[model samples]
Target: MARTSIDYEDVYQALPGMVALLTPDLVFADVNEAYVRGTGRPRESLIGRYVFDVFPESVNAPDAKNSHHLRASLLRVLATGERDTMPLQRYDIESPEHSGDWQEHYWSPVNCPVLGPDGRIRLILHRVEEVTEFVRARGLGGDTAGRVLEAELYTRARELQELNTRLREAHAREREVALVLQKAMLPATRQMGHRRAAVRYRPAVGALNVCGDWYDLVDLVGGHRIGVSVGDVVGHGLEAAGVMGQLRSALSATSRVADGPGQALNVLGRYANVVDGAESATVVTTFIDFDRHVITYSSAGHPPPVLLHRDGRVEFLDRATDPPLDARPEPRPRPEASVAFSPGATLVLYTDGLIERRREDIDVGLRRLADSLSHHRELDPEPLADTVLRELLPPGGATDDTALVVVRL
Candidate 1:
């Protein structure tokens, strides 16, 4: 075969990919320079070879890829008489550039059947592609790394939610335990006849019963006089409540033995210093003895008592008493004060929580308390306490725990 003028050479050489035209027997009829370059085979060697003979591995490597699968997929399109797109496939070809780097590819084959004068199909047309980049670019862009980090963040958030749920349950149980201990600390009936005194211990805004404020009313002087003391223990929580119980009991026992309100507080202060020791600090308190309308009281370093006159006038009676109970063991050399009750009036004694504020000074808080008392003169003890609790304490909590006592003379 001298030089057969196959004009297809010019068109095939210009093509971008490996190209080939096969004879009816599937032997290479004409192929491009690209095909020779890709397979590293001479044109004469590939010419007379059958298609399968050129790439024998294609048959054995079914899913293990070869151009044969591309040929088969094209046959499928031929049977269906439609166009087809093949997913990315791979092939192993030794190339000077890549060395051992496996070359991944894709192929598109279309049949252009020749009508051999007998109206019958004859030759097939095939195209080949290299789709390495297309396969690797699933989500390929600048933010690809960000997607992985986002998944990790979502997993960590779920773990934190679970931890918070467990922590909340544990905190609720702690509050329950504290309440149980607090209720056990109430004193039994300590008054006379039909009229009795029972403590309605209100909690701080945020806490349950963990406050230092407490009260004691003990029958003394053969039921003729009642020894009443309302005091603050210093801190909050079970620690403060425990200390208050100790001090309250000591005051009740002392009041029974002392002659008057002033004498009872004087002796109680000296004992408190010894029991709690000078190292620990304590707050001021007021003790009152009710000798059938002969109302006398002694004060400490605490907020003063509020006298609500029957005429609706409020007074903060800050009479100086002995220093706070645990401040020192030395008895106050100064005398305690006394006040005869103005009949049909009321006396309100309280701890710091009632009148003390977080931002304002003690004097300012006292003024507010006295003003509030006169403002709500007609309100009963319970409602008045509620009003003051809402107003005096901040929305969340008190800087210090408080206590209050109201006696309508």
Candidate 2:
């Protein structure tokens, strides 16, 4: 009969808690998976390395320091040939990938002397129980395990404060980039031949990300017709802004050759199919023909444009709308509607951010927008745009990118 020898190394590695064996000189002889994960160091890098050298306080700082308390505890275990329970430790480690930023960690450690057959200490059984989460949850370590970890917890609190500061700085930089991108997409106010047009854009105050809302104007070759566009790409951030820029450019180019808003939107549908992640968009494009004194407009799953008449009559330029970009394959032709522009009349083209509310139906928002416009119908173009926003939105304003273009004839 044959007997198989027990694999003691495999057994040691299978321990559930963090466990390690240190040589008499305090060098790592063995370590378990739990210990490797908790330290965030590979077993290969830790083995045969001095404990203090591997986990120094700061690797990139000019003043490199060693763990004096850890060294003292190990020496005590070796000299007395007995177990020693260490107090809560603020063993900060430098993250090489993070440019040597200090990562605060707390641990309850114990060292037991392993004596040889000749009654001399040969190895130390080092075990660590991590208590970082417990300390953070309690907001302080004083109440944790009879107030033993209060002093160390103060250091952890400082680390958290520093982390929050870094995050706020990053958010500020992001907001700046978003503002720049948004400004690049929208141009200054201009006159398209005979018609006067003005644009207004406001970014969400509390939103961390930027939205894709834009307005564009392009004059036709004959100088008698002008194309006006307002669109909203769903979602927020750099990707949305990028798509908004592309669509605005595409609509402008398509308008140069396309007949009217219906044809321009149909061409834009084809462009959306090729753009990655640009699944859906809503738009209202209008062609102002000064020769005929009429405006032709179309909607593609967008809120209709509000038309204010000289006689104080308010009407929405709504027609048989096509789906948003990429919403349906082989969609029917986008229908175009024409309305005669009266003298001193105003047209308001805007994104849904002007009227959309968080918990209310979209129809309610539309009615509110119409009511506001009817109340301020006599105001000039610049003040009219301002009044509509001031009335429809809250005191703090919308939490999404808003683009408003007002045309006064």
For residues 203-258, write the lDDT of model 1, one tens digit per residue.
66556565677776666765456655677665566666677667777777877877
Q: Relative to the unseen true structure, what is the C-alpha lDDT of residue 138 in candidate 2, on a scale of 0 to 100?
A: 71
Q: Model 1 off-target regions past 4 Å? A: 1-170, 187-200, 274-292, 329-335, 395-397
| Worst ten in a row by lDDT for model 1 | 277-286
lDDT of 2 by residue, 1-409 (tens): 0012456678788887799899998899989999998888889998998887786664433342336767888999988888887777656666657855777667778899987646788899999988888777777643353264755556776998899999899978988898788778778888765667878877665664557788998887665788888988876777778888899899999989997789888888889888875577888899988778888999888888988888778889986476788788775567889998877888889988888766568799889988888888888778888888888776756766788999887
- Number of the top-ranking candidate, with TM-score as the measure: 2
Clashes of each: 1, 0
List of clashing residue pairs for candidate 2:
none
